[model samples]
Target: MKKIAQFFLKPTVPVVTINGQITEKSVIELEKNLKDIRVSTAKALAVVVNSPGGSPTQSKKMVDLIHNFAHDNHLTVYTFAEDLAASAGFQVLISGDKVFADQQSTLGSIGSITNFMNVKELILNQGIEIRSVTTNPASVTNQSMFKDVPEELRHVYENMLQSQHKKFIDLVEEQRGSKIKVPKEKRGSLLYNGDVFNGKQALEYGLIDSIGRVQDVMKEEFPKADVVFPQKPSISGKFMEYAKLYNLFQTIYQK
Candidate 1:
């Protein structure tokens, strides 16, 4: 009876959560979790994402890490977004072989930006004198609040942002491939304009594969397998709770 029951038991699908901001610290924690999951007996992996996005470089690192994990373990990867997945979050979402999101889930925002505030006037008004002893004053002042950004420096920053934006677009094109319904030329204006969308709009724009809740979709897609979270849910739970509190306060303040 024991042998028979054992033989009937199905493999488990391990899940990883990517909630809140994606930073170097968060990616490091993920690396540790993946290292543990690498030795697991599961044949498939799932990622639950709910993030407004952060740190483009770290986001790419996350995508690469997950993709390598799938390759190394020969595991099928499924990604689901519950509330939000924008910008860097969307980058990580593309790592999945199949992506799912709730009907109300927010997705996309394929663009790049860098902001620096100039406080030269403020400091001057405060009667503070600032000096740069460096050989190249531009180097010290380019991004410093103590000095104004030169036109050439502003141009340089613009070019850098454009370059990053192009790379982001290219990544989406490469990953989604034929699944993306948007024409190549029109993608820039339509999909890469830093705008977000709901699941239905995402599907129409070819940003996601489907609109469905995580648990329901998991049951349907992997009926014989039990969904297992490889890491503790406390971290993600805390993040979501904090996010809710912040939003609540914002609403109250606005009202």
Candidate 2:
């Protein structure tokens, strides 16, 4: 009788959190949780994102995976922004079946960026002499801390940045169905400048559907249904774990 009753009941939405940098490890963890939910219950999945964005490749991969999972399982995927979801975070939001941003939550800055450091002055200031032997001339010639950056590396990075920027534009165009004219100058490497916009402005910019809360979405989409948050680690704990991993990796590589 109990087993028969289970057949008629739908499972609860599986909730996953994205609080920090979306790296390979983070994506894997999310995929695992989604898989568990798929196995345990035949229900929809909800992902809560509060991120400043990170690792474009990782973001794209995660979004692709989530989209595929929803298609395969015939499940609806919803995303709710708690505080902020910028840059690559926007990609994940677009992948959702329905996306909701908190009324005061921030979103947008749909772009990409890479950081580079110039350390020549610091080394010279310390009176440190460096010598290198490399099989390739370009390898040694391309590496510099004080001198002008090699044009080749600059072009390579620029090209990569432009490609990512185009990808972001494409995603937004596909999801929002609005034509946003991004000026040539604004489409450069500084596209992902970690900017935040309120929900009202986000809607104006066509970055999100409407200005509303997560509960509002649940009420509209799953009325008369129970909303559930799966058992999972808190966002703070996840961030701490990531910090530890980053520190360990830094220590090993620095040594």
Which candidate achieves the best TM-score against the true structure? Answer: 1
Candidate 1, residues 174-237, lDDT tens digits: the string is 8896899889889878898988889999898788898877677778877887777775447786
What's the count of clashing pairs in each model shown? 0, 1
- TM-scores, all models, native as reference: 0.82, 0.74
Compared with the true structure, the alpha-carbon lDDT of candidate 1 equals 0.81
> Candidate 1: which pairs clash?
none
Q: Per-residue lDDT of 180-228 in model 2, one digit per residue for the tens? A: 3344456343334446678766666556666666656766776655566
